[model samples]
Target: MNDFSPALYEVLYVSTLATDQPLSVVAEIAGRARIANAQLEITGLLIFDGQRFCQQLEGPKKQVLKLIERIRNDPRHTNVEVIHHGPLAGRRFQHFSLAFSTVEDEDALARMEQLDGSAALAAFENVCEELEL
Candidate 1:
């Protein structure tokens, strides 16, 4: 048998919610993502704060890009802006196929959505620590 591991890639993005009914819609999206992400060997976190979505996806390069393309084309999400995307040495969320979180208020959402690049990533990491996931 051959032992090989695919190159790992990660993507961080923020988007606006287009649907009026967020709770149910977000729930349905997360539920479907959990199964699909697992099959694709992806692991990450999804954060929603009423009007915005901040998500991080990590996996093999091709699969991660394809998943981001799908998210870009999804109607439920608008302004799908990728904050970061590139190689990762290891997984930040190895155990979760699609870990989910909700920002308690608009201030928290604004803080997360306002930045770009590594700062945005750091904000997400802070959330991960708070959630202890």
Candidate 2:
């Protein structure tokens, strides 16, 4: 019971958003999600490089899927793409309801240059490691 099984834990996906939504709007969205996710036993990281949003949500399989559907319907998000999804042997962000990172506007634009592949994901992960968030 004390061990975490990859078969039992799930990290829904890694998604990056494209939209005209402002940073404040994104922050507000994270705030709301944080409250709700806490109740649902969800933990995740929300990384926004201003223009794009890269998030990783981990929780029970069913709840994670439902949240993904809700996110798809949210008007604030457009061109939402699930980069990767699968069960995890461990949680990348277990201490948070929704951890957030805000990238400067200039950095955001620069990140786009690297977004064509895994570089983007690596950049976000670097931020998480750097900030220990």
Candidate 3:
């Protein structure tokens, strides 16, 4: 019997910070998520460009879906838009449970916000390559 799974799942999304959300809340969320994601065997990167957030989560399909659902309901985030989601051949962020980055390229970030589907995913991939992580 084969025990290995064929692929891992990943979700890519962009969201806006809630009007009343404090900047300090990002650190708090990442702190808690690191612990929880590790337990769930999830790995991902979170990018914050001032007012917007772009995140890519990779793990078991079920767990990733559940986490996205929770994120959708979190009051600290609004306009949660899932740009891409599906099975991935491997983990893009295997080492970090929830690695974080803050981007300074407003123009690039703006382009990502306007894209959807594969284009959006491509933008995210470009951002990942540019990141030091």
Best-fitting candidate, scored by TM-score: 3
Error of 2 at 131 (Å): 3.2
- Model 3 compared with the native: what TM-score? 0.93
Instruction: Give one digit per residue, the lDDT tens place, for model 2 in 2-106.
Output: 245234344323334545555578768988999998887778887766566667788777888889889888878776666556676677787888988765554
Alpha-carbon RMSD of each model: 2.4, 3.9, 2.6
lDDT of each: 0.85, 0.66, 0.88
Per-residue alpha-carbon lDDT of candidate 3 for residues 47-130, written as tens digits (9 for 90 to 100)? 999888999999889999999999999999999999899998888888899999998786666678789888999999898888
Best model per lDDT: 3
Query: Candidate 1 residues 3-110, lDDT tens each?
Result: 145989999999988866555799999999999999999999998887888899999999999999999999999889988788998988888899998866566657
Worst 10 residues of 2 by lDDT: 1-10
- In what order do the candidates fall by lDDT, top score first? 3, 1, 2
Candidate ranking under TM-score, highest first, comes to: 3, 1, 2
In model 3, which runs have C-alpha deviations exceeding 4 angstroms?
A: 1-6
RMSD of 3: 2.6
Report the lDDT of model 2 for residue 26.
76
Tell me each candidate's TM-score. 0.90, 0.73, 0.93
Q: Candidate 2 has which clashing residue pairs, if any?
A: none
